[model samples]
Target chain A: MWSGWADIMDPHSLTKLNQCRRERRAAILLTDLGDGSDRVIVEGDAVDGALGDAVANAFRSGKSGTREVDGRAFFLNVHLPPPRLVMIGAVHISQALAPMAAIAGFDLQIIDPRTAFASPERFPNVRLDAEWPEDVLAREPLDAYCALAALTHDPKIDDPALTAALKADCFYIGALGSRKTHARRVERLTAAEISSASIGRIRAPIGLAIGAASPAEIAVAVLAEIIEALRSRGVGAERGKAA
Target chain B: MSQTMQSAPPKDPLTIAEEWLKDGKEVAIATVIETWGSAPRPIGSHLVINKDGLFEGSVSGGCVEGAVVTEAADVIADGKPRLLEFGVADETAWEVGLSCGGRIKVYVERLG
Candidate 1:
């Protein structure tokens, strides 16, 4: 609980901050106007990365906030990475989801092992992980800002990704399927040892029941549901870096 | 190099500075670090400007963007960062910050 101004605007801190955003790391930049001491911290890292106790709460809440340390006021600007949408299918629906989600401000990644389906000609201008869904999730490891959508009705592709999403606890976990298909999915997942609670996290028959029939309409419904979940959180309440 | 591997466009305002820096251009970024009342843009919104007066994004919708861009050029040349404040000082200048009846504080910083 202290503060001071000690040349906080040095180029080093700003450079490191840019790296944090580039890497999509949740970070907080603490600026102490008292003596001008600036400190930066990336999530999962100690505030030691920050200059001092200026950022008392390394786990500070909210996108950003201001605090008074001693008599000096400190402005904490939290920069979370853009929300990531990881679609575990390169199906017709995904083509629509990709551009739509991008327009809504999500960083996109499509994961599918089916080479012909995952072809860039289909995904054009989208991030594609031709590797299996589990492998991509294992390598990338979804964060809170990530939303996982398993559109392939195939268990091999969708289940592993759904398992990964549940484990990662991403804010939104959606899977495309009819009720009958979803019931079978639940049994398969239960046999795979995924908890009912975790499986419950998925929004089955994913997307708002807009009675969507076409792939593009279904895409709109799904993207809308994702946005609803992302926005419905105390999320983006203020100056969150959600977008 | 497949299109799937093509990089997505930068979505964060902070990326502008990093991109312009790597492109070997003198750049300045004006960010809406704070706002009061009906400010147009939320905090962290940015307007990236180069020495050429070209800028991207918005800090105040249309109200104070021109002023911020003009000052960004000075920041680029002077290598100094400055805070800009804009809003209606009175009933007459309500056009200054627009009818939003709010004020915004933008921080303009020069980046290499």
Candidate 2:
């Protein structure tokens, strides 16, 4: 009987049988082998086999998988958003503000032409650039997640940055100055052809009027204002409350 | 381009909580939910506690951690959330060395 069984199962037939066994373990089956002229026939329980095939295809294509288990198809998708920030100064306020912003989920960068002010030691954890504002900002594209703040209080340092920030449509643009300083700066910017609406976008006297006197206190106020600005833009309340 | 992609390590409390969570441990998070005048930690400062009663953050200086950590351990073990409060009235405010006569309320939650 064994000899007869062996004779019935030839090498080609044995190979096909083994393949079928493997497919069955995987909840699928190959019903027919394809020749050059005909396609392969694969038949299995549609619920598991077809669904699994769809999921595999989706995974291979880097897309959300859709599979009907009973009568419902479940879709799975994953999205990871990008990070952004724009600091238009390398002053003490920037030193304090950058790390605080990072704690609240911002990617901070400091831009200034004063090499002495912008250094690894001064901004130990932030990115620093010792370049002219317009030259540096022009190369980086701004988006909704981006925030721009000028803390230098010097027109040479702040004006070019304000121009770039206004042009790029950054979500937040704040400049650190007193009321008198802001009035003078606005005049200069208006003369430079910045629109009133764009000028209005700046939050000069850039804080919540918390009577902040120290560098750390001023840092807190600036971060608070930035959070409020971000909240108004609809990012959400939790982010605003983080710092 | 480089100016847009730099950031620092998170605040100590947040960083500690994240590290603990990533390590697959249940953590208890405590926050200074409310405060009056002259509290050391202020509102929103945090303290995180692990299952073993080990803590990685501070809600206040030496004055309040002992009580807060005890409460935190209870929270971690029982998985029940609770709010703890510490305060001083105007008369005894100087006892705890809280110079600014006021009160403070801390909210403690168990986070797995």
Candidate 3:
């Protein structure tokens, strides 16, 4: 019921930004406060000067703010893909984790080959994949935005996903096992030709040293650990913030 | 995965704005450009409105949406953008101030 305005934001830019969001790609909407002009900058886009530095920082921190660049004010509205929690097993710990992770804004998914464990009745309202990690992850690969947790305690089911997560450099990679169990896992993974440095990234004895006994308690510990990884991402040495 | 990510909610203000524009409706987007102290909403939050007063999303908890909606009408009528401030310092605090005592600067402009 109206003619378009001459100075309105280009509809093309809005659509592009939304497309980036749907693609789980990072984007920044840069708007000049003085002129009300705007454009969308996808991650890895080459932007120059102080503004470019600001844009890069926003992409890393996922924080939105107004920056003063070259005497002009620009608002950088950043949209990073939501973090994904991909559980390698639909065990009891995952049952507790599924709901808790959702409350914390994670896109939680459970992948298990055993239909008996990944049944809809067990994981209602969660993304349950009653398929092998190899097949599911092949279709939807892991990314730095994803956190992979191997919980089945079975080498056949957990080892392959752990290998994939490490290869993909997932922000958080965890495997559930005792120290002895993890040692054997390390040996097997080492024999598989995965570099020790890459294998070292896996959080074994998974979760924090919270002395968690119950599955729900362990879920809390694991979620906290994932948050720690997510927050301290990109800064290699600052991971000592939490025990 | 990029190929399989679900769509954004139908009620998301920006999505609604794009849909409304595609439907040939006049739309205005209000964005919180800055916030101070205990602002209810963070910077970059959006509130979108159509010329018919239909709106979605919120720039504030619920305190200043009415004023933003009113200003959006003017933005839709004219192509000029509007920068609005609401806080304890403004003289119109009694009328449209944020009850949380925080300050926010919102930029509203028409969407083509």
Candidate 4:
């Protein structure tokens, strides 16, 4: 039953796993408890049987645990990239979000065309890009691991980044605006050729409806929402209870 | 390029292990494959050991590391993997202070 266990740890496998991690790719390091041999299975790599199901589950759950398959135990160590929070405006809410997001383990970045608001004095120790979101995002493309918050009320600054985030399949895309404002913005995006379905993914009024009236409290709501979106990814609609 | 914050500010054990391998040092990687009760570290926790007994990471709350490191040297020399189990019930574990009423299985193997 334990014939599948291979003792040698493949050097190339470790190298490949590290490369996958550095590239922000999801992977699983599967170690056979029978013979102590292991290999790294990337997210899209195909596998069959109970182990395949286990791998898929691990990827979705982002969990590490031992599994028994055909009387052989295997340890699946899941590695998902750290989540990123990209804010379109380095404004008051972002100023509050910058530190809170960092403490919450989100790599936060703020981009705004206005240098006055995006200055070091405002967002110290934060990754502040004093440039248009389109220009900054063109170089640093968004991906599934990223959560983009379009805080700039200006459509000129927010719309292009929202389109990019939607196109890149960002895990969470939120825009700061009221329901009425979002309706108008939706019309503009539709005029700009963005599909309604894609536009619908944006969370307008961008927060967990916690009655957050202040900038800092609103920042809390947005960060909580982003966390919810991240933790619930691929897990269906199992959302956390709102505070 | 956009100044997006990429936070890997501190090097983790696996990254250090890769670096040690690249630097041509003989290394062994010990992982916590299983844990029960109040094991301080969770499963998949890594403790990497180099030839000179220098190590990074942790498998327990400062317990059983010395033994794991000693065992790691043998793994590095022989290129054979080893599975080590420790529990509070064990005499050595009681002596070494894994007395947190927990158990853990560590798989140690040479990393090329």
The residue-by-residue lDDT of candidate 3 on A75-128, one tens digit each, is 899988899999999999999999999999999889999989988788887888
> Per-residue alpha-carbon lDDT of model 1 for B1-112, expressed as tens digits?
2233665674655566666666777787676767889887877677888887778888888887777888888877876667777777644336454568887777776664
Candidate number that wins on DockQ, 1 or 3: 3
Q: Report candidate 4's interface RMSD in Å.
A: 3.2
For model 1 the local lDDT of residue A190 reads: 97
- Kindly list the per-residue Cα lDDT of model 4 for residues B64-94, writing each as its tens digit: 9999999999999988899899998898877
* Superposition error at B32 for model 3 (Å): 1.2
DockQ of predicted model 1 = 0.17
Docking class of 3: acceptable
- Cα error, residue B73 of model 4, in Å, equals 1.7
Tell me the TM-score of each prediction against the true structure.
Answer: 0.65, 0.46, 0.82, 0.87
DockQ of 3: 0.40
Q: Estimate, for each residue in A1-243, the C-alpha lDDT of model 4 and write its tens digit.
A: 222336767777788889999888889998886777788899878788899889978887788999999898888888888888999998899989889999999887888989888888788788888888888888888988999999989999999999999998899999999899999999999999999989999999899999999999999999999988887776553233222
| Candidate numbers sorted by DockQ from highest down | 4, 3, 1, 2
Off by over 4 Å in 4: A1-5, A236-243, B1-8, B99-102
Pick out the ten consecutive residues of candidate 1 chain B with the lowest summed lDDT.
B90-99
Best by DockQ: 4
Of 1 and 2, the candidate ahead on TM-score is 1
DockQ-based CAPRI category assigned to the predicted complex of candidate 2: incorrect
lDDT of 2 by residue, A1-243 (tens): 012121011223223323443333211111111110111112222324554455334322323222455464333221112235678778887877888888988777888889888877788867888888888777765554567888888899889888887887666788888899999999999999889988998998888799999888998888888777755553332266555
